[model samples]
Target: MDSYDIIIVGGGPGGLTAGIYAGRQGTKNLILDKDLAGGIGREVPEMENYPGYENISGLKLTEIMKTQAEKNTEIHEFENVLNIEKNDDGFTVKTDKNEYLTKTVILATGSSHSHLNVPGEEEFLGRGVSYCATCDGLFFQSRDIIMVGGGNSALQEAIYLKNLGCNVTIVHRRDEFRAQKHLQNMVKAEGISVIYNATVEEIKGDMIVESVVLKDTKTEELSEMKTDGVFISVGYIPHTELAVQLGVNLDETGHIIVDKEQKTNVEYVYAIGDVCVGLKQWVVACGEGAVAATSAYHDIKQG
Candidate 1:
């Protein structure tokens, strides 16, 4: 077993930003991530909203942040935390491979892509259905595909696919898009077609995806459209199971409840980023991370 001043769960921008701040304050910290360090943000093809950079890929932004954080913090990738416990001294974090002790723990585990739960969706998960456009867009190069959702990611990824010579059709449950105006305009400018007030009923295929079945929200009519793949991006569910199990307070929607300082109900425990209640944005997450780290540093100094 090892010990540290701070332990951050999840390696998204929020966790990495926390590491940068904690490290600069001379706090011994460790960051644990289940898979790649970049989190879902890495899947974005282009990021125009993050400050300082006019245009940067999510992967590039994550890389730059990770590099700076590594100057002071230790990051362990591919480590899935199984459980966390609070004890008299501090905290204990158990991962699939090992365990560690830390005075404070920051929960930054982000959200995952939501599924349509329609028939054949499970059967064609890898064959023709995917949640990540950046990872699977190449597979459908020059082919037609369906994008589900009306969020920023859905539109952004649709634009990426369009640039790859693939025709894209976006299906949203509502007539209006929730994505930024710029992104919506971009999708239209790129000639991506949209299906509004529609929902997926099923994904039909032989071995691979052949088409998608859709239901009209207003009329309850069913229609089928041919496509090579379906990219789901409806919304995200926060990875808050661990935090909930640890007795952390959460909202009705399962987001961790936190204060302005990012402190959770549990002592020495904090929550930030997509896991907490707030607008799920990279900049917002990073700001929360900074606040959590600074709060933790001062709290430790007091004790």
Candidate 2:
């Protein structure tokens, strides 16, 4: 088996960013990813607040980072690591297609959104439907958009979308919101529309998302509302199957427990980005990736 100083799993922002940093430090870092290097960000339509430029497409941003990563480290594409093990020294990572050994492993697989699982939700993905508000909100400028969920992220994003000139509507299954009181007040003050005790029954559109059939929780009545796009922010599920199999400790919320430096409890192992228990965001993931790589570098240097 080929071995390296580090073997990173997941090729998204966190993993790819970490690869660049680790490779720069002269570490023979290798990256293995089930998906491409972009992760959810790549799937996003647009990204307007990623720093640097005023705006950039998620796919484009991913491509830039990916190109830099390729120059720094060796990348093994299309391999989904199924299991992990630790020996007296280094670690072993087994994927469906291959195996690898490395002194350090950084987990940056990221997480998947909690799907509505409703009819047409899957069918409308990318066709006037999305998950990241900051990523796809601009596409619906001046058009009505329905956001599912009433949490801070949802309400806040709705407010942001409103600022972007989109008529915003917030739909939640509960009559009352579970977000911070201030945020609830802000959404109300912003004149953003709210639909209470409602759940989207189905998304309908001929070519793109045109409207949604919403069902009232109390009356079971269904009604259709016109919209150009939909943003789902209900929740997310961490990509922790690999971490679980490797005996890494996870918080009650199922995110891998990491230190301030993004190092996991396991020696020479680390977790970063949304998969770890902490803030989840594009900038935060990049920061965490840098921290993880720096910590690993120091640890290896001392060893």
Best by TM-score: 1
Cα lDDT of model 2 by residue, 113-172, tens digit? 898999889899999888887778788898989999977668767877888999999999
Against the reference, the lDDT scores of all candidates come to 0.93, 0.86
Q: Which stretches of candidate 1 lie over 4 Å from their true place?
A: none
Q: What is the TM-score of each candidate against the true structure?
A: 0.98, 0.76
Q: Candidate 2: what lDDT? A: 0.86
For 77-170, candidate 1 gives per-residue lDDT tens digits of 9999999988877998999999999999999999998888889999999998999988999999989899999999899999998898888999
Candidate 2 regions with alpha-carbon error over 4 angstroms: 117-145, 150-170, 174-197, 201-213, 217-231
Worst 10 residues of 2 by lDDT: 41-50
